[model samples]
Target chain A: MSLDAVPVAETRRKGDVEPLVRLAGPDMAAVDALIVERMQSQVPVIPMLADHLVAAGGKRLRPLLTIAAARAAGASGPIEAPVRLAAAVEFIHTATLLHDDVVDSSDLRRGKVAAHLIWGAPSSVLVGDYLFARAFELMVETGRMRALGILATASSVISEGEVLQLTRAHDLNLDQATYLRIISAKTAELFAAAAEAGAVGVDADDATVAALRAYGLNLGLAFQLADDALDYGGQSEVLGKNAGDDFREGKVTLPLLLAAARTRGREDAFWDRTINKGERTEDDFRRARELIVGSGSVAATLDLAWDYADLARDALSALPASDWRAALERLADFAVSRVA
Target chain B: MSLDAVPVAETRRKGDVEPLVRLAGPDMAAVDALIVERMQSQVPVIPMLADHLVAAGGKRLRPLLTIAAARAAGASGPIEAPVRLAAAVEFIHTATLLHDDVVDSSDLRRGKVAAHLIWGAPSSVLVGDYLFARAFELMVETGRMRALGILATASSVISEGEVLQLTRAHDLNLDQATYLRIISAKTAELFAAAAEAGAVGVDADDATVAALRAYGLNLGLAFQLADDALDYGGQSEVLGKNAGDDFREGKVTLPLLLAAARTRGREDAFWDRTINKGERTEDDFRRARELIVGSGSVAATLDLAWDYADLARDALSALPASDWRAALERLADFAVSRVA
Candidate 1:
């Protein structure tokens, strides 16, 4: 289809894909189709549950990093490695989501009922396990021990991050350092591993691997910060979840932590009622949101996200100027700017 | 210490293994210490919950298979592989136990509280996931893909078997073949994998690996059958569980299924009260046990267990007359004769 004929809204933002879509020329369509095909597999109820998320249509940012990283490394061909790499990333993400839903007893995910709610907790748990195991099998079929080691280590870190989160839940005493540790383990580690292994999948050298890893790490941090911002900012529609869900869950994210710190003595009753006691009424959410918004923590959090996004861009500067590299640059913008 | 110094009561049974104990020597002590050490690492409430089951004290059959298989392969140094192997098997077993308790909503395990009962369901679920991930990492350090493959495949089979059990639950129409598949996947697969991987860890030859696998498989099947028989034979103390707990859970084990078949026209009411309706009272247990025993299914089940035990012994017949092999032969007898 001609670019002019494409739907304006369905296309990424105005500047979002304009530069990179031109740079991508032809391979981007193939990459997108490859991801979809790879996502389709028969694993009892797991595949159906996964499709709910995979097709719920979040930006496929991790796989994009993978393909972009492969291309930025100056490798060219109908190389199947990138496809498997993309599939592996998706699998890891899907597996984590399945477990996350169970861990949180979450009812809604991507604007749909969570897998655990739909399929029961046991099926959801086993399916998550199945996907993780299958992801390992995919990596093994790639014939790279380095890739296996990278992915396996990331999976362990992911689990650890989750445990850390579980431990810290409902604790209002949590700080930015602990929050950062959780995000790095829970989210950024997989992002870093995905980009690192994407380059490694094509035998990218140490320098390239390091660059892509840094890129993914920064981008992932920024991505999660933006997610926290969205949670408080009432960007519910684009984010595909309810506004103030985090506050309801009593999670002390950056905004809440900063707001609580700034108010210190004055909002002790608010913190006690919302965070510690978990008795958040609508008035509580409104008051909390107003407090966080008024304290400038929302913009401050966004500032940090932008800083990380800029760092992510800087990490990509070492790579050659290619369409894939340009697409990655656009991705940092999309990740930080999206309501989701 | 000399063999005579060890307790005679622990070695006087029909399947007694004074020889294997002597061969194991100090290593048996080391393995036991490691088991306790590893079990203690489950942090706070988890460790307390795990201790309940650990102290309930299984035969440690899977770990013993690991040790014996390694020894049978003529490995004579650095028992870490066996130690690690045994630990990994226990971790996998413990993980499954946690999941099984959740799936079955089981209140008692070995006459003690289930992990889910002691810890909340979510905590039990995550701890199970933790143990599984820990087990994988430990096995991965072994650096043998074949061993990892065996274990990963067994884990998948276990999940599949559990799902099969779920789907077949309360369905009295289930046949012998499906029942065998369920048990094979849920029980024997892990046992076989443990033995085979133990052999693989020590670089056992193909023939030895095959023999150990068969031995473990037969022993596991025999062990489960004996457990089923005990449910009908008034051996609650030996099993560390209530007599006819399987019937209470609406599980149609070999003895129950055979009796149902023999009961013919009476099967409908039995099925209604037991499997389908699931309103099993003390009287229900009494009548079920009576029917199973009176129909001679318990004897038939015991015969089947003996057949597997004999097969396990025959599998070891070609091995050189080593103390380890002799211990394994005795283990086959013990597995069937334990009545649990």
Candidate 2:
């Protein structure tokens, strides 16, 4: 279905994460405490630099997924294991963000100056490593080998995805399938692993674990797609990052690729000059955004994100009905509702 | 004892690694194969960048220590676990080297062009991450949680050490204790983990594992001390990197710290101009090297290395008499012999 088929007011009504946030609050508090405790090191700069990013907290959505998955999987006794795993999931996400800032030379993250700008690229790189290693240490303490393997493989896949993106950065001709593959690897794999690890940590049955993983994968895709759409249509103040960052960096996202395809022959020179040759100006980004919105690419991207969100909600059918399950379903809607 | 107390020829005779290399050749071949196989990825650049560093092979000393420690601890049946752990050790080391080159902005590594130069710094950072994740993947395959813990902790310590070094880069006031702490974390901790993980993987006793770890720790210190000395005294061709690289970068290594202290009043302006101010020139480097050597700082550094070498040999006394033990004893001496 296209975005035109749905009412804007109806879509906006579906976008709320309050249910999941309230349900996961106590567990997330534990996870947050663990994150703070583990990130501490005798090397003064490590915690200082790490705290700069961790403190300027984003949604903490990945770890929230871990905690929710564990609760949904019927974990009853002490959830110390899931709590630790959730902290680890956040550490891995933060670590990747730190490295990505350095790799992309980003100027802002979570509405604050990027860590690399304040601490220098060298410190950012090393501190990212420190957090990555700490993530594994936390997993080891959990004594869950399968969960460790899931995150380890996910980490490798994420890096592979990142390198793929780096190599294909400014290519205007990047196909839809390749773009999907890049995002699936770089973003969804971690989501899948985070949920799968939590289920496995609690010794959930195979069917339950697989279902949670599927849910996380689809949810992650929806979130990323919505994020890409927001970059074109949403306000920078609300988004916590500049709106034209993707266009400015010549990053090839689904919206840009779709817009470029829609405007093919007419805007070929414009696309080549701004994206391929990398000679962009303020006027160029403004015009590019107008072209993208006018071409209906943002609506198309949101439509695709809605499809993934529906799939994510469907994947929760394996679990018995509970408040946690309903909360997760709403969270999926929230992933796409950001642009509303 | 001072360098004058020991005859030069006697110390030279103690510095060969041939025995260890010859004995570990077969196992190292297996590790080399695993390294080559695991580094390959569908993303062409991952393997290409990884191969650039892996192919321009260093001594592979860390993994060899892993193999020898397992063998010395009497791992008899199939030795597959040790072999995999050895490969994991190598991957971890190579990953660190890739990041370290980017961090230091070095032009040469393992006697060849640094990987970051061929690819960009972004690629180098991500590829290093890929190898690191792959290292954990390898360890996960062996089902050795304790070994994973050891390597995981080592990885954390190494980054902390690197951050410490980066923050203190050009400080002429760096003391010997902090210098040792930096090298211990960045260099020696991996050596200790490599050996300790091997022993632990083979189900060796606590005493035996501790001994091997001690041996690795001392050998690592000796090797780093000798490397710091070589930056001032050794030939560039033999060293596989430019001599005076530490001086050029204003790195506060042990030899520089020693020399700076020895000529404190006499060469205050020279040290201040070159190191603290970072206004180094070719002539400045030459003069600094001359002062370091003429002041007998290199000899004093080598003397400390020899002391660590002796401690490393002494730690091996816990293991039974075996070819592996003898080879490891010689490897400690080889750590110091690089500058010979």
Candidate 3:
């Protein structure tokens, strides 16, 4: 667990996202411009609240996937359509984050104070609605109904996932399959749709589009699993949120579920009180993390994440070997490598 | 102000929406069917929470406007596109209601306990989002991008208006123009878009489409103005919500604005205490209502509504003579007449 115990070569083997970021820089800049231009409104609170989150900026990974998919799928001419679709995808993601913060009552997002906390929940909710509508407006401007449908369905599926999670997230008995389904719906679906819409926007062939969508889906699963693992094994400065947020909120993510199942009757009272009864303290979180880490649950989660990352990289075999494809392969490696 | 002072003929002259309801019945039935079918999801909570609102069923006036506009614009053939758009419009409206109740923390909607109360605020917010995504999915099915654009823009405008109202709702100094802007964005934009999308769906001529949009805008303005008046003047049973909700929330609608201006110095202290200070009692609401009514503010609000209604009726002159057109004119009249 100490830095001295870790092998230097293994840390060096952990891949980076720098290649994808460097390659997609120009396209992403255009997407960012579109995002900034569209989030503005005559109402001051809207732009102010929206910019609080949008300006702070995350990895911008979803839209980058969108643009990468378009180019990787052999988009040759002007990439304006894919660029706009990429912006729309970001808008949709931002909107969901706004609503999610309000729904979860989380205190931080993208390493900044949550928009809902600063502007109040009502403004956050309304501005979320505004961004969502603007996303569709951007899609409509592309005159691509198929891409619109993809994002629309993804949006619906995401909410359904959110509702399912809200209803079942506190259950101590939740199985891993249901947890995966929830993450697939809430997190992975948008990734898949973002890639699929980008391909569709570029008039990519059906096979190419399907392959990119598969890549996105698996990459999303890997990324989310790694994220879940990171919550327990990583630092707050790195995660942009406090460790044990899931534990404190009684949210039964994969790490907790795995640790619960592995510890079975041994930690019954501990798990029951913290998760089911929703009673916890600083010491309990420390103890819970100890158990989760001591059981090798985080390692098991990262291993599964690596499997998905491999599958994501394998999906790129369908495409012609190019810098975009190679970068995407590295990106998938980075998905799980970040947890290393 | 008593019943004895009201003219019998004027009571009879106040029009009703029955004609439009009856005429749009079959198309609305299809729209209703679509709404029920689309709101269903594997996530049981989604349908249950959505049904809690959708099943209570408001007047369906917005969707009816969509159908009526299509038919009145001389769509002689099958009106499938408009029917779908009508359902989409209702979904948007229902989604907003879900978010609005959560934002306002209201107790009732459509004579039922608010969805957020029955489920939870988190569930309500997510369900609203699900319905919104489903709305765009429905619009995508129609394959009319322009229609989609109209609804998308309206959705954005509605959210802007909502945020505006949320920030300014407690301001006693809110001007008439700003108040009108808020209502137009929050309440009337959907109405205008519903009718406009309907006409566009039916491939109506540019003039007819413009006229229907105008009709919808005016009707929505009139309907919102009347509803604001009804908060002070009408019964809770008839209004499907507590009559004084706006007053209790300190939402400075047109009726309150007019009353504040009329009372000026006399009720400045009362307005300051109730709205600005956010302190209220039963006696304060009663006294405020008396002041609003005694100053003829409700009547003035209704008078403005009547003007909009007349403008709505005038918009119908662009269409040919038909029962649909006549019913629409009556519907406009009913918007204000309900306050009588």
Which lDDT tens digits does candidate 3 get at residues B73-182? 88876799999999899999999999999999999999989989989899999999999999999999999999999999999999999999999879998999999999
Give DockQ per model, in order. Answer: 0.29, 0.90, 0.93
* Model 1 stretches with alpha carbons more than 4 Å out: A1-57, A78-86, B1-13, B17-22, B25-57, B79-82, B110-112, B232-237, B240-243
Full ranking by TM-score: 3, 2, 1
Which digits, one per residue and each the tens of the lDDT, describe model 1 over residues B32-65? 6765665554235545656666666666678778
Worst 10 residues of 3 chain B by lDDT: B1-10
- The CAPRI category of model 2 is high
Residue pairs with clashing backbones, model 3: none
In TM-score terms, candidate 3 sits at: 0.98
Best candidate (score: DockQ): 3
Ranking by DockQ: 3, 2, 1
* Per-candidate count of clashing residue pairs (backbone under 3 Å): 0, 0, 0
Deviating ranges (above 4 Å) for candidate 3? A1-13, B1-12
In model 2, which regions exceed 4 Å deviation? A1-13, B1-13
Instruction: Assign candidate 3 its CAPRI class.
Output: high
Kindly report the docking quality category of candidate 1: acceptable
